[model samples]
Target: MTVLNNTLTFRRGLTLKNRVIMSPMTTKMSFFDGVVTQDELNYYSLRSGEVGAVITAAANVQDGGKGWEGELSVASDKFIPSLSRLASTIKRNGTKAILQLFHAGRMTDSKVLRGVQPVSASAIAAERPDAETPRELTEDEIYHLIEDFKKATERAIKAGFDGVELHGANTYVIQQFFSPHSNRREDQWGGSLEKRFNFINQLVDGVISVVDNSNVQNFIIGYRFSPEEYEEPGIKMADTIYLVDKLADKELDYLHISLGDFKRVSVSEEYKEKSIMQYVHEKINGRLPLIGVGDVRTKEDAENTLANAELVAVGRSLIIDPHWTSKVLEGKEDTIRRVLADQDREELMIGNGMVEFLDFMMPERLR
Candidate 1:
């Protein structure tokens, strides 16, 4: 068996049966009201149980922060029951379930927010096509948002999730507060990099406080982040290193560096020599577990990724074949489907929304 079958134990005392983790992906299978549907349950039920853990798609912590249609939400206690169903579905076969939480911030439009203006650290617009200039959050609103995140963690615990992953990556609200392109305020939430870290700092602290008080034991909290942004004056590798250094000292379980390719070198010119994962691995220095992910599709890929990270996360490959981990573990890797066939859609439990998204985003992989 490959190193992917090795077990991993988080600092908080939680253990995974293996090192392979299923990366979070948006399925868009939930109902319009953010309720979990059977389709979504079926989707997870089929894909889970083989991986050590599965981080679910980004779920909004506040109603106003909804990122897309049919996204999951833990914004209110009322969602606990529906989310419980999701947690149980993913927990089948002893696999850990982590609910990813985030706010779209300016990444969302008023249309997604139902005519309400999106909010961010500042009034800046995201560096994307037709991005709306979001309303700057008031101090009170920021505090309320932190509380909302804490409440979301409470909901996750009550729903029986093994943990919650703070979706601080992908230019979501947490990253927006840290990005120079998005956060242009002079207040405590912006200005210097240290100040910009206040939101996430408080967020981690809040989530930890909730977990500490809860009856559940070994509930993990992971942070995911994009290392750099392409926009001028955006997040650079140095900024991310600083953030990593700070996070290493926190009560975090792991740091997941979001990358399109696990072996990709730095995006910024100064740090172009080594892969981004290499840089982060060096900086983290084993203080907290690191999860490496990007296009990992085979046993060799997962083994190579384990070189730099304590855990290897597989995303699209899991979409192509939910039994990927089982097949690889059973020495049946040769039988694993590397490409998606038209007939594999329903058989693979890929949601209609996800199929359309995959077609638009990565058509080369689908036949």
Candidate 2:
């Protein structure tokens, strides 16, 4: 029998023990102020020993970037100790930790920011029915936000994290700037594809400067991107390929690929059963280590994706079964639980609070 071990290494010198990586799952379990909680610690630790790396839920980089009530935050130094503890717990359990730094952009609820409007490429509102309309960022504000990302990267390093993944997908601030439908500005940050890419370039440059220094060489810098906007027609695969090529020289350790926007929960279901990374892998051709995510639930799916890509990312599957990766590696495929469509939909739409809902939605064995 062929042993299906899913370990993979990248040119950047970071080696994942298995191809199964836990994709960032938003639990909304953090405190209202974004402090890490014991529940989150335990939840992540349970799966840490099973996967290669655990990318945490998005941690907002600035106060203005705070989008949801329970989302994690790294905007302040005071949050460092707690974040450091979380990182240590995951690493102690044998999985590398990567903090996902994000800016909610227009998707942020206005209530959380205390009446301050969310910022994005233009004064466009998120397509999500529940999202608030956002204020367009001024030229100066956009430049300042770039610096904020750099500072956040520095903070992640200070928190003893192994790496940081930029949340550029799911219609976040970076994604807003990338999509022409959202970024209709007539300025340097908006007109052509090159200009649309300028924000991401500056963001990567700023973060790399802080993360790739001699002292921080071991820190992996990665990006989570969705080239297609789901329902929006403007952003295409070619744009994403161009963006990937642009960042190929930035010393990125990995690329995590996910499809659809945060506002479009419906499209997420389509990606839930497929590996979007396979397409991205073929496009990049191993230019950098690729992390394939989307609807991977079984050992067979993980092995197939890893054979073609560098890594496989599991989200809902891990939430339902923490030891999923270990079971797959040990050739106990039958032990792997099957996730239902409704449960997957609930998780993606309701975020972290859907765990209890999932228990009710799935059979006892699957749950």
Candidate 3:
């Protein structure tokens, strides 16, 4: 079998049947109470059994962490039952289900938060024109938040998921703690780069402790990160290299980089010759597997990405074609959907909320 078709085993013994993963994307299809709804179960069910694994939409770890309307919640025991159904839907077809954990930090507005001001490592606001400055998290609050993550992981294991992925990208709390623009604290959690990483250091350690005791066999734990930031004094490739180096040493099953284009080059001209994933793979140096994702629309795209990273995740492509991996592997790549239409919804099992989000965010994809 080819590299993309071969089963790859991780450090902890969990193995993927293939290299294609369904990258986590928000669906806004859950219930208002943060419970997994039938719509969500159906949506994921349609896409499963084709890919090696599915990293689900971000599940907020606390009530205050909800980033958008209809987001999933693993913050409490009450959510576990529905979460179990969601997990089984994906895993029943022999695909691994990984629940992604996240906290929005300052990315959300007070209106979405229901009058609660968003919190971050520091009080600084994002550089976006309409971004609101978040309230600074107290030292005690920081510890509590880390516990929230651990608890969420515990819940994931309870839900019978194959693993959990820390949503460390997309300007969320984890990225906020690492980004210079977002985290400006003078305490041990901020200031120097090493100090700024303290939160993640403690977070991974705490989570590993939970998994260790749970005895959940072959349970995988992964971290996803954005390689470079565009903000002033933001995280750059060099900084990401250092960060990846440190994370790779932490016994993680894999490290996934969040990027829009799988073949995108470095934002800084200094490293323009190589793609960001290539640079990160170099830094990783076989310490751990890396998952590369973004705009991977074809069999060739996934194949090429696998050259640099051990696994390839596709979000938009899978959205347009639910059976993408199967089609490619079956030598029916010509039948793959590169774009979508209103009439194809039933065939692809597309959900209404998914169509709306894609329309507003990427209208061109819909013919």
Candidate 4:
């Protein structure tokens, strides 16, 4: 029971209430123009009170970075008012809100972003054929992208979010550079792990400068990382430890960790069989608050993870049951739904609202 009582408050100057965080789960319910929809608002609001912090679904920083059709975007000012409204709604329910800024890198389908060639650390394609072959980022282009992240952070702050989380996990642009298999560049932003992490470091520095870290109470900057590159064999716990040590110097507020990549999607069975969070917790050793996200389904599981890690992040489990946190806290774990192991991807429909909304927002040819 002490483990359940142990609340991990993520704080800069102020504090979030508890250790339960709603991990960033992509809900492609954004209007074609990037504004959040009513359905999106309802979805987040449902989970707000039960969790300590709510990290909004991935919002692309640049037009080229856009991966899916209905993903939220902060590429322009016109989208801010609606986004602000969504953030306000989440905060009204007593949860700290953070926006996860993302870039798909080569994982983006060319057909989606107006035939734009995806960009990455180097001219490498993701292991999947659906992913486009990315153009190697030029020195000028890399700097421009960094500024794009800075501007997005400013927009997130204006939109009433408490802080921002860099989407560096799951074979995204940042992770692509961090992993040796994808990043084969010879420049300053490539080669060694330290050089590979330089882009993320620069992005963080730019964001911290704009947001005024001290003034923004409860200001949290989280980075999501995957130590085991599901696509390649080389990435290990040691690599992740090195990455965390470097990021700690940058003053990252939290480290959200999970396993697998776009190439090797982690299924529920694999998650239950392995202690991914424990491995990550051992590596972190309390340097920064560790956020453990995977297949955390039961309250007991969440409590166990919290005993070892700073926070427990629930993803698909919450999608299946929005009141999952409250149910677990109240010892009603039996009522919580578990995502089926053999469930078809199409049948799962976690972000179904986006699919329904996209039909009315954009025509099929454009979508």
Candidate 5:
């Protein structure tokens, strides 16, 4: 087997057939009521069988956590039937399925929240030009949010997913709490660096406790995080190193970093020379598997990425080539289409919303 064809066993002993995991991309294909639509199922089914695993688009863990239109939800048991369809569709191709759990926090627009003020660790606004300052979450609310995540885990367990990936990356609630720029709480939820991690600590502990008692074999838990941010008082490589150290010791199945380029250099001046992936990998130090992701488009790219971490996640590449892993394994790498074309949309079963996203991302080709 090629490096990409290798089976990967998580800490919980849940194994995947290959190293090519499909990175979660927002499909915007779910129903407005937070139900998983047929479009969502069809989309996942197309790409599910070929990759080692398919991580579903971020599903809000609670009602207030929804971030985008058509985002999936595991917030309530009422949504379990739809969630089960999502999990089963992905697993039908014999691939391991991991559901991503998320909360938008201050990143959400009030309009999206139906006029509700978005909540965050502090009332700080994002640096975006039109970003609104969010309402600070009260202590009771913070604890409730922890339960919210645990509840989502329960839903995932009931839905029959292989695992759940905490959406700690991007500018979501988890990142907001971890980021100094966004978190200004003087209470237990935020303040000093260690206190900032308190939320995640309790969250992981809570989720793990549930998974432990579930009696399901190989129900793994993974975390995805952005290593650094551009905002002042934001997370930097040094801070990420600290966070990784703590997370690694927690017996997580894997640590997945969010990046646009696997080889991109650090935003922090002191860590300028080394790539962000390298910095994170060094911090992990093989304590747990690390899934390296970015613009890993070609077989060579995947192999090179494996040099830094244990696995590679193909996002846009998978968006354009649903059978990317299958092609690589079958020595049909030369047949892969690297760019999107207008004509290819129909056969790929692309939904109207997904087509719009592709159009936005690759306008020239889609046109």
Candidate 6:
């Protein structure tokens, strides 16, 4: 067996049976009201057991933060029982379950928020076509939002999840606050690089405070971030390195770098010599465990990723083959599905909503 099967333990005492992790992918299978549904449970049940941990799709921390129609929510106590079932389903056969928390920020339109104007650190519209200018969040609103994240963590703990991943990547509310292109405010929450970091710094502290006070033991807290942004004045590699340095000091369990290709170098004019993984890993310098993911489909790919990251996260590969890890563990890698076919949808437990989403975001994957 390759080193991919090796076990890993976090500083906080959470141990994984192996280095494989199921990266969180939006299934859009939850109820319209954001409650976990049976379809969602079945999807996780089929994929959870073989991996070390499964990070569920982004769940909005507040009602106004909802990004899509079928996304999950941990904003209130009413979701605990449903979320409990989800955590139990994923924890089968020694697998760890982590719920991802996020808010869409300006990424969502008024329609998604039921006519409520989307909020962000600054009143700016995203660069995308037809993007609506979001209302700037007030100081009181920002503090309340941090409290919302804390309450979400409490809900995750009560639901028996092994951890919670703050979705600070992909231009979400957290990333929006950190991105100069998105955050143009002059308040304490914006302006200088350190000021922009105020939102996530406080958010992480609030969430960690919940874990510190919770009765649960070894409840992990991880942060996911995109290493670079495309827009000028956006998050450059230097900015991300600074963020990594700051995060290293925080008591986080892991840092999951979001990338399209694990081997990708900096897209910015500067820092193009090494892969994003190598750069981030160098900055981390063994201070925290990192989860690396991007187009990891084969055993060799995962093993290679292990060279840089503490854990390897497989997303599309697992969606194409629910038993991807099991097959790898059993020496059946030759039989694993490489491309997703239309006819395999039912057996794959892929919902219609997810199918539609994949069609839009990753059309080339579906054949």
Cα lDDT tens digits for candidate 6, 90-183: 9999999999999999999899899999998889899999899999999999999999999999999999999999999999999999999999
Taking the tens digit of each residue's C-alpha lDDT, what string does model 1 give over 5-31?
Answer: 788888778899999889988889888
Q: Where does candidate 1 have its weakest 10-residue lDDT segment? A: 357-366
Candidate 3: clashing pairs of residues: none
Model 3, residue 255: distance off in Å is 0.2
Ten contiguous residues with the weakest lDDT in model 6: 357-366
Most lDDT-accurate candidate: 6
lDDT of 5 by residue, 180-261 (tens): 9999988888899999999999998888898988888998999999998999989989889999999999968999999888
TM-score of 4: 0.85
Quote the positional error of residue 154 for candidate 6 in Å: 0.2
Q: Alpha carbon lDDT of residue 261, candidate 4? A: 17
Give the TM-scores of the predictions, in the order they appear. Answer: 0.98, 0.87, 0.97, 0.85, 0.97, 0.98
TM-score for predicted model 5 compared with the true structure: 0.97
What is the C-alpha local distance difference test score of each model?
Answer: 0.91, 0.76, 0.90, 0.74, 0.89, 0.92
Model 4, residue 48: distance off in Å is 1.7
Ranking by lDDT: 6, 1, 3, 5, 2, 4
Winner of 1 and 4 under TM-score: 1
Quality of model 2 by C-alpha lDDT:
0.76
Error of 1 at 235 (Å): 0.4
RMSD (Cα, Å) of model 4: 6.2
57, model 5: CA deviation in Å? 0.5
What would the per-residue lDDT of candidate 2 be over residues 1-367, giving only the tens digit for each residue?
3323545666557777766778887777788888998877877777787677899989999999987777899998999999998899789555789999999998787788988878889987767787776888988999899988888888888898889999998778898999987898888999899999989988988887786564865678899888577546467766776777777656788888784211122234444343345445666776787776656767666666566567778876787667787777777878865654545444333345655645543345343
Of 2 and 4, the candidate ranking higher by TM-score = 2
